[model samples]
Target: MPEHRSATTPRPAAPGAAAPAAGRGGAPGRLLVRVRERIQETAEAVSLVLDAELPYAPGQFLTVRIPGGGARCYSLASSPHTGEPMRITVKRVPGGLGSGWVCDAVAPGDVLEVLPPAGAFTPGPGGLDRDLLLVAGGSGITPVLSLAKSALAAGRGRVALLYANRDPDSVIFREELRELAGEHPGRFTVLHWLESLQGLPTAAGLGAPLAPYAGREAWLCGPGPLMDAAGTALRAAGAEAGRIHRERYFSLGADVFAQPAAPEPPAEAGVEAGAEPAAEAEVELDGRTYRLPWRRGTPLLDVLLAAGAPAPYSCREGACSACCCRVLEGGVTMARNEVLDDADLADGYVLACQALPLTDRVRIGYA
Candidate 1:
């Protein structure tokens, strides 16, 4: 064994060890953190260093709740491998609730509540020896940066980033990305595409940079069009069909979560106009079944939670697939889907957070 170091000394990781996990331990819940430091990345982008010690995977996100500004999910911006303060980047928009408050108001030592990190857009614990291709747009660079840094920090594989922005002035983490490329030498590379300077991005334009990386799996996060175009290009260029993964960014306003509203039943059995039928559910999880009161418009996850059923969920905006479950019986209607490719949908899978009960009696099982 190597000689023991003092308490203040930061020990090195064991040889061949992978980077720290990209997700925190245990189930998701609300956590309070003190703002330790705030670094401005651009006029609109800011990175917050939280005092809280959270064990989260790269590409995961936290749903932060501002005291009076409501809650919204933002991706983790720092690498867990560095053991530095956990950080999140926010690009504020005018009239925005959470982002605006965090960017324009919060400061060091201020306390804020945040939900535990929850997302499946993470690279697994497996030895990431394979090449990595990262494509990001606008604010989607947050999680991509984390994953790239973690992969480089672990000294596991080559990482390439193709970042798109409106202009050079609007690029977030411009300096950090340059520093990363410089420090890592040949292991890490980055390409910037500015719409104002290079015209709008195209499949051929983005595909050209990816040609050199013959055997790389891609992770995409950005606007729908960019992701779709890149996916098409990569697939056309012979990249494996399922090798390109994507994470969509959702902008939910004052409504932290959009729950399908259940109209209050009338005191009398005569009922009121537009009232939905009294629906019920049989939800199965952990080998047990629970009967719950469900309404047509109410989200299946809400109904399960209200009736004390153990249903897991995070980032109710539908971007994160934490609430996904299989509909075993009856029918459900999903309001939105940022996750779940066509195959998963064809398999009768639905996000419980966005799915509404369509039939009077339904059965759902966690997948």
Candidate 2:
């Protein structure tokens, strides 16, 4: 099977794997972690080394509660394949509540409340056997760096990175990337595009430099414009659509840590006032099957949370795929979905936080 499928496809739980924690008010359980060290990556970006150890893939992210209120998701910069401590890089955004606190106020030894690692932007099982083409802009390099290092250190594949930034002063992990290139001259390659020297990237311009590696599996993350340009360039250079993956960069508008609002009544879903009572839903999660009442208008996440089922989720707004699950026996419709492409939908994936049942007897699995 193709490697990216693992990110969207559910698989059976391994023996001795930890079960999901029961939901707390429809939010994933939180962990309090101490900041072991803080590295100044750039003028506006800071990398926090967390003292906590948890199972996480290289490209996953942690949803952190802001010091005051609200929350933000920061991608992991450390690779689990390597022996590095868990770390997350935060780039300060103007007037950003979460980034501002972490960059300016957060100090070593400070305790932080964060959800466990969650995200679908990861290279799945056996993902590092083939050559990889990575593109990053600004802080998007965080996860890209993790994947690059993991491929170089643990896998047998060639890795190429095309990183763009405002200028030399703005490049994060410059020294480390240099060291990697030096260590693996044949297997690793780096290309830096400083906007200070080259104007904003264009598809036609980037196509030439990326043409050679266009056939490789490509992963892109950065600002929307940069990603759009890179994607266009790759496609023009003969990259297959299925071989390219993208990570959208966004800030959550709602606090995922907040208690989920009560679901609307069945009438809201066009169910008759005197319709039959809610039906039972069979949900498979963490190797356990749960029988819960499926409310007509209620989202699956809310029902599971109310029942104390251990369902996985982050960004209840459907902006992230942490709550993604497959519908095996029935159908569901999403109220709103910002993630999950057409291929993902065709493969039976749905965002549990936004899903409303379309069938009374629905069966779902988290693999």
Candidate 3:
């Protein structure tokens, strides 16, 4: 059985490999894990149990590289506080190569190439003890369940879930949630919304059920419409905008498993002629610190990779939080940030792929 704990212990890169780029799978920063089991959660959803004991927080996701198909991120539903195998639930999307392959073709005993767990979706420092409001729709329930279980088992907070689904039979983790509720009757509450009976959820319609959780830390995941409505409803019910965190689901459009392109020259990439030397950045990654000259107008990830630093990243477009790092000293600005919420920004977290140095002598760490 996998060790269960609330704190994450970093997993070493696959033996004989380096960070993000060189791995046993012939790709940088990939690991090969065997499928321990395959579970059908619903008609369109399946959960794959991996036979590895690496550490990961509740809401973090794994980037799995399909053999012929590209990479796709799937949230881990298994709680680190629970003695369950590392598992990721995948729902087959109408023509999605990654989700479709994981759900329909992958089977027990198959080997998969995956990037280690990455994302800033996990609870922040001391966040586990705060009351939680989890709003999930469709397959968004995947990460929601993980956070709920982790909190119930490891924290002192009350947990409530407002889950929306297409219909009764389409609710993933139905029995598991019931068991959880039974285990912690006073600490756990679940409100279900079935579209077949209630029609599509609207902000006005969700106000009643979401009002009770308005004061709690909100974590929203699901489709665009559902998340938007939930956010609106929460805010209307008095939830502070900074207290609401969200995880957006999107398919990776770039090949994360491929080698990254060479960084452009500082002078060619629009550095001022004979301007003050580019800001200096001290990057802490994989237990080593490297100082590099971060050119203006260049993303931090580009600077790190160019200097042969073993930083992990996926989807340089900044939609995914795979390249998240924290600023310990100076500040940086993100060109585009689709994942981090206001709370994350307030906590000094930024997407390295989108970050440009805002001050000289910046220091960032990825622990």
Candidate 4:
């Protein structure tokens, strides 16, 4: 019988002879950043810079967490090349908890926790060597400005920016964008759109046909209706579907149009108005179950936190999917879900921040 090779024998390494260590999967990176400066961009909007180095892509965003209040997502408005400092522009929504904290309580030298960058809105490879068109409304100019700055810094010259705001004073990064336009000369074009301009033309009135940049990539970000209008017009004017990218801000007004109608509850499961339930509900999260007092009309998230369960969450308005969790058992009614796709929802994924427990017991996990 022929001698059999030992199956358990380890292979020998080459001259370098180094072994690879196990990779840490999905570990969170935290940064402590102090506010370096803050400027009022508008009556309700402000731009802030941090004395910290945050490595991030052009269109990526950071989650700004306040001490007592929750966190909110803000797009990075400055380029990485600026070095050692990161800047983000924020627009305070009326009655917003996070916005009010950042505007009123946050000050220079105040330190805050910043999560690592996360987003899928960055520019693509096809954007290379093509004339770039950017359309922004209100505070949506943040990410667009970052992309433009990155492209210019990389020596990718052909670019144009069309920024729209309520008025000239509300335009974020006004001086910096103007300086960039001046530096690039004919290469960069900026169209300022003001709804209240007495004699000036609006973005819709710009007679310049989009045919000149037929093969160009277009980026749009703003309020839902404005972004929709700009995207529709760009497509109608011959911009390719694959080349047009967009991002939308959270809007209570647009939620009606953006969200699908919620499913109605069964007659047998009707909740009594102004009457506290006899018993509290329990939700199982991360191997621990917490009981929450059954308060009428209380959101599921509030109940979870009140019961001492640490659930991951950002942008409690239900727009961002950061707090997404999978329902293992039972049902929940979502007030709104702007981030999850149909396939995700079908897979039992739900935004824990927006969900209301429809039953006495629900099981969820941060899968």
The best candidate in terms of TM-score = 2
Number of the top-ranking candidate, with lDDT as the measure: 3
TM-scores, all models, native as reference? 0.70, 0.88, 0.85, 0.61
- After superposing candidate 2 on the true structure, give the runs of residues whose Cα lies further than 4 Å from its correct spot: 1-28, 260-273
- Whole-model lDDT per candidate: 0.69, 0.77, 0.78, 0.59
Q: Which stretches of model 4 miss by more than 4 angstroms?
A: 1-27, 82-84, 125-129, 198-211, 250-367
Q: Go through the candidates in order and give the C-alpha RMSD of each one to the true structure.
A: 10.1, 4.9, 5.7, 15.5
Clash pairs, model 1 backbone:
22-56, 22-57, 22-58, 23-56, 23-57, 24-55, 24-56
lDDT of 4 by residue, 183-255 (tens): 8888888878786783343335543634455467777777657666666667667776756676645422222
Query: Which lDDT tens digits does candidate 1 get at residues 1-367?
Result: 0000000001111211111223232222345678989999888888898887665667767666656545677788898787877899888766666677778888998876665555556665453566799888888888889988888887478998989899998889999899999999989999999999888788888778776663587888877788787877788788886667777655543344333222232122214366765566787664578876676666776666555454555556565675667778888889987667777677687888788878877887752
Clashes of 4: 0
Candidate 3 structure quality by residue, lDDT tens digits, 149-194: 9999889999999999999999999999999999998999999999
- The residue pairs in collision within model 3 are 20-28, 20-29, 21-28, 21-29, 22-28
The worst-scoring run of ten residues by lDDT in candidate 2 lies at: 1-10
Instruction: Report the backbone clash tally of model 1.
Output: 7
- Candidate 4 C-alpha error for residue 2, in Å: 74
